[model samples]
Target: MKHKRLFSEIKADLTKVEKELDKLLAVDDPILSKTCVYLLQAGGKRMRPGFTLLSGRFFNYDFKKILPVAMAIELIHMATLVHDDVVDASLTRRGRPTLAAGWGNTVSVATGDFLFAKALEMIGKIDDPGVAKILADVSVEMCQGEIQQIWSAFDVKQNFKQYYYRIRRKTALLIGLSCRLGAMVSDGSLRHMWLLETYGHCLGIAFQIIDDILDIIADPDEMGKPVGGDIRQGIMTLPMIYALQSSGHRERLGQLLALKNKKEAQVQEVIHMIKNSDGIERSRTVVDKYINKALKHLEELPKIPAKKALRELAVFVGERSY
Candidate 1:
């Protein structure tokens, strides 16, 4: 069997899809349009859009139709990031100054809202009420997830279950929804839709788990942002939670949390402690579970090139070091 990375095999299609994303996001107003385009230009893995296209392959395989949905999905994602900067008080994304950093909170928030409105408008043109509803509902869940994260921030007393729920809503919901919507757009069977939806959900959870892991393990240059960012913000992730709960470092973690200084040296120590402790291993195991669950969904899909590509994507998520 010939093996090719999904994106590499579909390079031409992906390129056109990216161009459509650029076109849809173009705006006339200098400030709002520029800020909106800035974040898109900053670059992302474009995984959401990738999933959108891959899932669509199961049905109509129309890049023209799929591109708008992909752009809308990305816009929804970028909007959340802009708002997230304000909520996290973050200054940088992908190592560049964030909208909140240069434009101030009000402008950033309004820009996010504008992008969201644009996404909704695009969805309205899709002509599939079911697709429209799914996208709209997932947007709600995404917002709710953000609100939940804020509510749970710095609350070390929270458990793994609460942490899982937060990530699922905030991160996984859209990914799963993207797959589901894509499958719907392609006119895929209900069984395929269910499988793809589940696959996207598991992959999304794994993605977020990797994100948390990289916070401690990845180099700042590679990550395009500082490590220990979540720690500096006092938000505890799975690895941190596992380290605190499973290891005997609970007291130490508590002490670090109580500190007001939070110097770079101290934050590095906390990161080192989390890394060297059982936290990274435990977090890796958690990711493995999601990866396995994702693979199980793939088993039901017909054996084909796209299915093989998706399987590799899942393993790539769990096994990727950076």
Candidate 2:
């Protein structure tokens, strides 16, 4: 089934929420308003909002009703990115200057806070304490994950367990919450909600694992960022972990990590070594494990077109090249 098109069907509803987000964030300050609008207009995959609406189908499919929840989840995600650009010192996203790069760090930070506050305001409009509670708790976990990632940087000894735990908080938790709250806002049964949440959790993990691999394999034009970014930042993701496990390349990996300022030549050399060191295959294996678990969760969901779309989504993440 071509579930890729499923998201397109909800394009109208998603666009509506996008408009609401813009209206809510309308500020008087010219620079601040421009920065916020610039980021919003650049747009992203809108994957969190997609998760919310898709999961909403099993309970009560009302785009108008659940739009606030979907928009709130997306705002939370955008807020994280606005801060992440500051943390990573990123110059580009989606092939354009980041807010922090264009504006200043101070301005960027306040804008992120403003977006986050807007998200909270939207959540309050929903009037569901359960949804509000999960969002607040997940926001804290996301912050914790970011902190741990920053702390662990340049530590070559960091292991797979630590890496997994960090990504679970940074990436997977919000995606899972997006789906869970999507179902709740739609009034899904407990069982259905749980199933969707499980699907989101495993799928989110798989998505990030693939993203890590893409960071190593994709070109800047395709990935919309410089290659070897995580490596350059001294962040060891799954592929790097598998590379470290190799007895033969331990010394080489150490040399690559120990370097203070890595040149293009050195980064390419390490990239080539990692491509041949079975690290790529090992990371793929781990991703498959999570994808299988996600498919299992899909099997338990009610057999509907939307559920089928979710299943195809799992497959797409595992196989997508971009």
Candidate 3:
């Protein structure tokens, strides 16, 4: 399997990352430590950190210097997940009860805050205001994205531009930061850093689009939630947006979404309506576009093993289901 192959190639470094993450999460309060560990252990591809590590490799930078930045990127990602679960009222993630589900919202939120603080501490060790400013800007964009998400919920009138920028703020900015900062810390050329940032941004947005598709079609066990989860939550993802715009069932979908609380059958109806339309295929088309954009950025970079691995990583991003 490519999964095993990928891990085998990066095993030693990833092990270091895992240990660093665990050490960083250890805290004074047992409850805080336990909750943070629980969330971190919830299985994920760790793709953000993986991208950071790969970008760092372009300069063949010291792994020790890169580790703190890579770890900080991952910590930010995990922090977002914890807060996201509470915001979405998600009960399960990766088939385990969420921090919000196992503990309460307050505890979950506090744990997320702790993670953010720790991430900032790691950034502090770098001792660069420029780097701190980058994270600060991304953090502001992320909060704005969350606000936009709440306002855009169940919104049928939303256009392509609105959805595009929302996902950029929510996912792409930090991903771009990871790659750019990886290069920055590696002392990469400005041209190389910006190119990597662009690559990361395109890849991250595509990743989110695929995630939404998986939320519709992937197995519950694999997806960590039931199908139609977004539909039930009234989040208008790309598939749903396309369906609302083009599917003949738009009226019925609109009617269903009008309800303050959509029932199980109604959510199912919307899901199938989306699948039966051009939504899934069209959404894939958009994913492909972003991926192509990423590949173009890679084209400008020097031919190196890390660059090849990044290309493979881009393919993996598109093919990955969970």
- Which model scores highest in lDDT? 2
True-vs-predicted CA distance for residue 210, candidate 1, Å: 0.8
Against the reference, the lDDT scores of all candidates come to 0.82, 0.85, 0.83
Clashes of each: 0, 0, 0
lDDT of 2 by residue, 111-228 (tens): 9998899899888888788888888899999999999989998788989889989899989999888888889989998888888898899988989888889889888897778888
lDDT of 1 by residue, 128-197 (tens): 7877888888888888888887877667776888888889988998998788877888888999999999
Estimate TM-scores for all models. 0.93, 0.95, 0.95
TM-score of 1: 0.93
- Summarize candidate 3's per-residue lDDT along 1-322 as a digit string, tens digits: 4643454445578778888888888787979878977876775777677777778888867787888888888888888889988998988888888899999899999988989998888888775677778887888898888889888887877778888788998898998888998888888999999999999999989988998899888888867677777787777788878888888978987777655588788778877888898988899999999999999999989887778888887888888643
Q: Stretches of candidate 2 above 4 Å error? A: 1-4
Model 3 regions lying over 4 Å from their true place: 1-4, 7-9
**Reference-based TM-score, model 2:** 0.95
Candidate 3, overall lDDT? Answer: 0.83
Query: Which candidate ranks first by TM-score, i.e. highest?
Result: 3
1 versus 3: better TM-score goes to:
3
